[model samples]
Target: MTIADLAGTPAPEAASATARVRTPRLRRYAMTAPTFFAVEYAINPWMDTSTPVDAALAVRQWDALRSTYRTLGHTVEMVEPVAGLPDMVYAANGGLVVDGVAVVARFAYPQRAGEAVAYADWMSSRGFTPHATQYVNEGQGDLLVVGPTILAGYGFRTDLRAHAEIAELTGRRVVSLELVDPRFYHLDTALAVLDDSTVAYYPPAFSDDARAQLRRLFPDAVEVSSADAYVLGLNVVSDGKHVLLPANAVGFAEQIGELGFEPIGIDLSELFKGGGSVKCCTLEVYS
Candidate 1:
């Protein structure tokens, strides 16, 4: 199989290949972009001192974050800088790709206004369809795929309008949750559903109604702490028994191990400043 095969598309061997090369496999993913120079705003454990030093630490964090996933065996791709769009590198947020189709996101931030179009173009070039947002909904990061249904969060990175749109497009039931904090901007920031019957979350970010719904759906899931959420570690991703977490979530790794997942940590502090974690830096194609 070739890289084209992995992307679920065909590429003429002569057009881009010297010979047939083994294709890279794909995985399921939720995505996001880095906030340019946005590192200045990350919630750091050591931020009481000078601003410049804090900013530098944020960069190191981002590098560590990206490196974490790379070590876990993902084919990570970084988008080049687009002037004016600071968080463009978190390409996964521009849209959600189910299979190989792109669901163009309606960014909640006006500063990221043009990203949808640019991302759509990129998707099309890769031989994928660019699906539009239904009700101004952001993609992957805010839409949690649990079993066959999607639990969408509103108020911070998505809206009810967009929530309805996603449900219609994917033919999945989308339930909305109101975001309770600015710092946990999107659902991925506060909640992570590891499997149909398993989930991890940071309680304070959920509204009373949302919390009730979560409990009803995943009563048996392992409840993680807020500090682990800060590292965005429980944003738990799996590659067989190998689970990925943020480097800072060393303690969380222990918990994942107890659950039968071999914890693998990645340093992504710099990328976190733009408000993203392990789930954001990856694009997976689960066939």
Candidate 2:
């Protein structure tokens, strides 16, 4: 289908209405800018930027990472600039579009608090009906939709209250877990749905219960080491059999290649500094 054809479809009906019984699609995904992504400057008190070169390099890295998605056949639409908050420009990060509807997020940071409003406007302008998360939760990075189930991370960026609210909004069973590792504040940092039945994850980031739940849901998950996981770009975006990973991760790219699926890698060093990989920077909505 053409890009115009893809973008021209009307938003799906509200989840509460009977008209909302269509199958959810997962065709395209999006990513945001890496500029102004340094949390140390805006949110992190410990962040000290001793040089301007570091900031310039960070922006360069972010641009390179965003282009990597395009090289993989996935459509990359640049969300316009949001003054002061560069992260806000990547409209995909503000909400999750399941099927054709947009699920708006409740940002945990006060600086990011305005993203939801801007994202809602973006969706509406595109003929999408936006849904909001209950309580406070960062939408793009906190939740992952695998088949019929939504895996949500609770703690740090997303709260339990938001989990319950998401369940109420979509009427889908939200499997919630408390993130044990503070470093990986979001689930994308440690876990990923490779396919409907297969997953790639770092064991140290998941609790016993969460691991059990994962096995029960996806009995075919291929466990990889945290070090390998880092190299694997475990959270890479998937389109049918195609997977996009980080360019620097050679071993992980080779493993994915061995699986009969095409693997494409791009350099994402700048985005990593902001605590996001391929998946975190984008939101995929399919029908």
Candidate 3:
């Protein structure tokens, strides 16, 4: 069925909803060094601490991702990694940055709660107007920016109440999308915003209503396959023209390239063992 049919909107209405809207390209990002790597505990469905993780390999993979960003002419800033906080390496969970202001995350899990302090300090030091969130929000892990709206995910790591707080804090429109699959707990895991007007997402990760809303809004979105989604392929980072995704996601990479985007695949397998890849490692710091 067509997206218009699914959303119960006229075809013309759906067409207008996805009309091109250009926003400034993102060039700066915040990342945390994976100095301490170990899956001591499982916080998300993707984490299996019972199996051992290669700390040395994880560091090399992370460094490669950072190097990839640098090669693309993007600025990469670092946040100091604490000794015991292993999850801090996924810097996107630290907060959401938009329009030069950062809405720092108040982590839902105690394991990650302390990370808010370091993220806030870095954002403040970087000249961003930092606003600490009152409700539980996992930074950009559950928050994504599309053209003129912020697509937020709930029913997982982030609380729905934070949507209002984030909208008020960033002065942007927030649309809440409920996540259904535990594997795709964070919105970033299931959706990759390629540009202000384009996105790639896994339909099975979202609730029926959320899927319908996505259909209504992004009629031209690429629907990801289960194979790619299984490897955290949808967890990608894009800079308008280039999309950096997991090397294992060959099909998704080809699809992205066919859409006129340069898909740069980087091996983040070791980090994937910790339930994060490209997008999770890099947090956009809007200029």
Candidate 4:
């Protein structure tokens, strides 16, 4: 059943009644400007090099996303975009910082490998102890923090072996899930960690085994629509009480609103050309 069909009161009523139950979390994130964003090569199904991307529009949209985070009282830091890495703007793939320790990203594709080095150095410069990862793990793109667990994704961009590496690096228990859909290649693309104990996901994007795991873990999770999933709706950034997602994901927004979280929609259509949205542009830094 779709989220709307699930037995519940109207979102407006539930939100008004329960919104105060969730505590707002102050977040710190690292973002990269879309200075070098381009669809020059096809890395995922959403990208087609032939479709021209408006460079100016990309910058404007990225600026708006960054501003949105700051406007919500979250700290946003920037890493200087390198000249050759176009996908660098998808900063969540760079590396992940958790509890003051950073695990460097070892990208599965050689096309984006340089991004790992940049993030490792950047985190080290900021006083974080950076740990080099031997296995292929695309940072926060595949590694999501949910309470004490690190929900990792595999079968596409990240290697399953990387899950153990991440667990060893951060001392957080890592649970590996397999992605079956090419369109939803990363965990963040199909699932959003709404809070430490909650999530919203597109079930079809994951393998059956993975879906079972999610159901056992988050029985009350929001199952998003296929329409919203196609628009990269699950690629969201949630700070406990506030969920920020792409403007096109109206249905998913309403679903989260029913959970008493205020959903904030922002436009990142330009970045969508590069197979990313709000969460892709944002990497949480747990300090």
Candidate 5:
């Protein structure tokens, strides 16, 4: 069945009708400018590089997205994009930062491995205690911080061994969730942490065991439609209140609104050719 067919499935009742609303706090983010386009074919399932990406349009869309964050009262830092690194625009993969500590990613692909050093240097210069891991990890692309724990993904671009290294380095509990679908290669693609107590995810992207674990941990999780998931809908950026996602993900946006979040959609269709959306372009830096 298609995602539209699953749209009718009733969402789980929220844990509380009046969930404790937290004030939106200032968020620091890291982003990169999309100045190059080498994605001519699908490296991951999400990209159809053969379709031809409009490089100029991609830059405009990215700029608009950066502007959106600034307009929302957030500080966005930039990491200088290197030549020949087309995928560098997805800044979230550079490193995972939490509580002033950064664990730099050792990318699984050689194409992206150079980004690790640049990100580490940037993080170190910014007063973050940078920790470089020997294991292959894709930074925030596969690691997400929710509440006190780190939700990590493996069985795709990231090595499972990186989980322990990150946990040891950050002293945060790392819960490993295996990604079952190639399209949802990163944890951020399949899951969005809306707040400390809430998350939105696409169940089919994860293994059954992982889904069960997610249910146990986040009972108030919102399940996105398959249609939304197909367009990387759950790959969203959310502060405590506002959620930014792709404009085409109407179903997911509606669901987010119902949960008391202000869902703001921005058109990032051009970048979608590179296998990413809002979350992939944004790396949250926690103080």
Candidate 6:
């Protein structure tokens, strides 16, 4: 059965629901410009203090991703980037917006803690009632929306306890998954939700139990190779039809193409130094 078929999944926000059909979705997303993007601290495995980050290159790559989204007929909104907050460019970690409810992020590390307050204010400005979580949650980096189901990952950046808080905030069924690999610190690092009905992931990133749950839920799921996962390939943004991904993840591009989705590759190798790509740079604004 599909994730949509799961019991207790939240119903559409509107009382009069339209039929679920395949059409080009005009997606709305929130992004922060990499005006102050940098790698001053190491929170994840991909970050290194000694490595020189080309902020100019990062901005160029980010602008290209934004342009690609607009070209595909998607709305891209900018959140003002704060100086001294280099990681602000990874906007997906700002919050999780579902059915007009914005569950703001509670970052695990002190380095990123200030970002929560910044995103909370931004979310309120965009017409969402911000709901704060007591448990540590890093927004879409760990919490992914699958139709009405929320796939949450923990054992690294996010605390597992936050999954229940997420359910209360969004009124959706939260499927808690464990991230076992240090390299795949966040769920988006190892998994991609292709559409409402399907997902692709790296098996070794998850725990045995989490892997079992995934296998049972998405039998047709694409299993990605280490070659692609290492390059943060699964960190992609999809509007059901087209997927925007890092240009280096050729293997993942081919796999998603087999699933009949157009994979649009954009180079954000500079941003990868900060530990994110297309999906990490974009946060879906559900209404």
Best by TM-score: 4
Candidate 2, residues 1-287, lDDT tens digits: the string is 42212222222222232211222123565555555555445332222344233557666655655554554455666555566774563344587777666788788787777778877776787788988765787775777887788889876778878888777777777998777776667777677666655566777777788888877877756666666565436757666455556565555555545554445565555555555666766777655
- Clash pairs, candidate 6, are none
Model 1, clash count? 20
What is the Cα-based TM-score of model 5? 0.91
In Å, residue 138's CA in model 5 sits off its true spot by: 0.4
Quote the positional error of residue 216 for candidate 4 in Å. Answer: 0.6
Question: Model 3 compared with the native: what TM-score?
Answer: 0.90
**Pairs of residues clashing in candidate 2:** 25-286, 25-287, 26-286, 30-282, 247-266
Kindly report which residue stretches of model 4 are placed more than 4 angstroms away from their true locations once superposed.
1-20
Clashes, model 5:
0
The full ranking of all candidates by lDDT, starting with the best, is: 4, 6, 3, 5, 2, 1
Q: Please, what is the whole-model Cα lDDT of each candidate in the order they appear? A: 0.62, 0.63, 0.85, 0.87, 0.84, 0.86
Per-residue lDDT tens digits for candidate 6, residues 224-253, read 999999999999988886777777787777
Ranking by TM-score: 4, 6, 5, 3, 2, 1
Higher-ranked by lDDT: 4 or 5: 4
lDDT value for model 5: 0.84
Stretches of model 1 off by over 4 angstroms after superposition: 1-50, 53-73, 77-80
Better of 3 and 4 by lDDT: 4
lDDT of 5 by residue, 1-287 (tens): 32112222223334246545546767999998998755854669877756888889999888988887887789999988888788889999998999777888898888787888888888888988778887889999999989899999998988999899999988999999999999899999999988877899999999999999999998879999899999999888888877888788888877876666767777888888888999999999976
Error of 4 at 54 (Å): 0.7
Show the lowest summed lDDT stretch of 10 residues, model 2: 3-12
TM for every model, in the order presented, reads 0.75, 0.79, 0.90, 0.94, 0.91, 0.92
C-alpha lDDT (0 to 100) for residue 31 of candidate 2:
52
The local distance difference test score of model 4 is 0.87
